[model samples]
Target: MRTLEETLAWVAEGTALCRRAMAGLDETSLLPGWTRGHVVAHLAGNAEALGNLVRWARTGERTPMYGSPAERDTAIEAGARLPADRLATWFDESARALADAMAHLTADQWRSEVTTAQGRTVPAVEIPWLRAREVLVHAVDLGTGVRFADLPEPFLAELRADILARRGPANVPGVHGDPAEVTAYLAGRPHTGVTTTDGAVAEPLPPWL
Candidate 1:
């Protein structure tokens, strides 16, 4: 298992990379597919939510930053129009706060369970990793041309694991062929296979979000 410090570092680095990628964009670029802005906003909201989770883990409080899905969506929509600098600042601050909290956790604390609003229990140690994955993956979803290869290897590996574990073969669009092809598919890119040994091909991703 990875250390909490390692997970925190990865989250910090991924957030920084995402901020850099979103820097200096005009409204047109920022609003691509009507999703670029929403993607960034969603990430910002995720940072806040994960930070709250860290706080709750430390304090044994069940406090939640957003009360419902509607509230979370409102937060994201409001954050979408924030200036690039402000967005970056907010993300950086949230990441730092989360990292600081994680740094003080003991191994026992890391494994402690926290109940989410959905009533599912999760380990503290997994929170940062999940947040890192969210930041990195959604950065690509912003359609700023950021590729999966630009992400850190450890994150990509984690993403691979997540896709394999959470997504069924029939449900994963664009997946076909070998492991490399599957990786590419999950990254929202096209892949070609040379042999039949490669696995079943699937439909392309839907155009609508």
Candidate 2:
């Protein structure tokens, strides 16, 4: 339930973080089995796919994020293989296009129902949250330096809530520590400082994302 303005600012900042992390880098990302090139390409592909949803909202045409799961995976792989300079341009252009699409949605259009790549139906207003989550989380996943602690506090809480809502409660032992600590655990990121309510170490959790 974030306001569009707030989400846009967060996306912009996260995009900047990602840009810095991927600059001149063709190395491994924090994500296993993904290079920085893979990460950047995925981001660029995601921007375009999500734009499809926005277009559906605006024009009442039914456009799914991708034609199929295989199509999506293939697209990411193809983009990842592009030359480094071309890959950067793809990300930059796609990001700009998505931002522009989000900015131009009318009030009624924002209320349009759109199905996510995950098959969940949500209002178009949720698009911002979806894109925000991508850039912000992937920025940290780039592992060039950004961490959960660097994210806005409110967004952390929102992310935590969203994860729990989908994953069904914080089944891990302990109440956990700060928002960043809990969010880090939920996101499957490396983190310390999380402990149970009674000072016991929090149990490791299965991947939620």
Candidate 3:
């Protein structure tokens, strides 16, 4: 786990990566069936939704991330249709907004409970980690040449642990190697260098998101 300050810095770095990758919005992304626009749109919406949770923490209101999963999906699809420049603007503004909200959080506020889109209830401090994962992973998903190796080691380790915790060793069998390679394999991203305990190339895993 990261300190709040470290997590905020992580978010900033990931956000910068996304900004650089924004130039490829019109192109196909690593995510099959979704363009880079779709990925960025989802990131923008996610930042805003997380802002709602920050507000909930600060004010003691129960602000859920989204009204429903379908609502979140519809918003992402609609946002993806915007012109490229506007889509970039949307991502920038939402990211800044979420960062600002997180920055203003009191220590007590950081500990306040909030529910995730996946229905997991967690403290507000997890928001930055969540946003970090979003910006960094989706930066690669933009498919403009960013690779899993481009991500920070600490973040990748946390991500690998999270995937294993959620999906389990049974779901990601024969996995062992460099942190980046393991994370890439676990995330279902295009990867190389991952190997099993026997030193053989690791098999591909199903979707992990």
Candidate 4:
């Protein structure tokens, strides 16, 4: 399992990469697409949501940070309009708050369970790790050219395990073959020995979001 400090560092670095990537983009680059400004909003919203999870873990209450999807969407949309510097500031602050919260957790606290947005129960220990994945993966989704290979090896290993264990949506894309191919596929790049007969073709790494 990843320590809270490790997770926080991942979020910080990923957010920085996002800031750099967005610095190079104009309004056109921020428009809607597979990888777009909306994705950035989603990431920020996710951070807030996870922060709530940390609160619930600490307090044992069923408090919600976002009352509804519409509210979440509105926050993200508003964040999308922020200038790059302001957006980066927002990202940094939110992530730092989350990291600070997680850093205070005890071992028993980390094992506590809470209800996720999907209405499923998950351990608090897993929340920060999941959020770290969200931060990095969605940064890629926002057209940051960073690939899985660019991520820390331990993070990549953890992500590979987590994705394989989950049964929900394939958020990373392109996983129709061997493990190495799956890794390449999820990284948003095609593997040399892989072929897609159906489903979405694995777009190149750091896709033109």
Best candidate per lDDT, number?
3
- Candidate 3's C-alpha lDDT? 0.88
Off by over 4 Å in 3: none
- Writing each residue's lDDT as its tens digit, candidate 2 over 1-209 gives 66778888888988888888785447888778888888888899899999999999999999999999998888888888889989999999999999999989999999999999899999999998898899999998877888999999989988988887787764545466778978998777777888878988777676555
Summarize candidate 3's per-residue lDDT along 1-209 as a digit string, tens digits: 67888888889999999999887676788888888999999999999999999999999999999999999999989988999989999999999999988889999999999999889999999999999989999888898878888998888888888888888767667667777878989998888888888888887877566
RMSD of 1: 3.8
Scored by lDDT, model 2 comes in at 0.86
Q: How many clashes does each candidate structure show, in the order listed? A: 0, 1, 0, 0
Question: What TM-score does model 1 achieve against the real structure?
Answer: 0.78
| Candidate 2 residue 52 C-alpha distance from true site, Å | 0.2
Q: Rank the candidates by TM-score, best first.
A: 3, 2, 1, 4
Q: List the residue pairs that clash in candidate 1.
A: none
Q: Specify the poorest-scoring 10-residue window by lDDT in model 3.
A: 169-178
lDDT of 4 by residue, 58-148 (tens): 9888866578878887887787776766766667777778878888988888888987776778888878776777766665545546555
| Ranking, lDDT, top scorer first | 3, 2, 4, 1
lDDT of 1 at 155: 61
lDDT of each: 0.65, 0.86, 0.88, 0.66
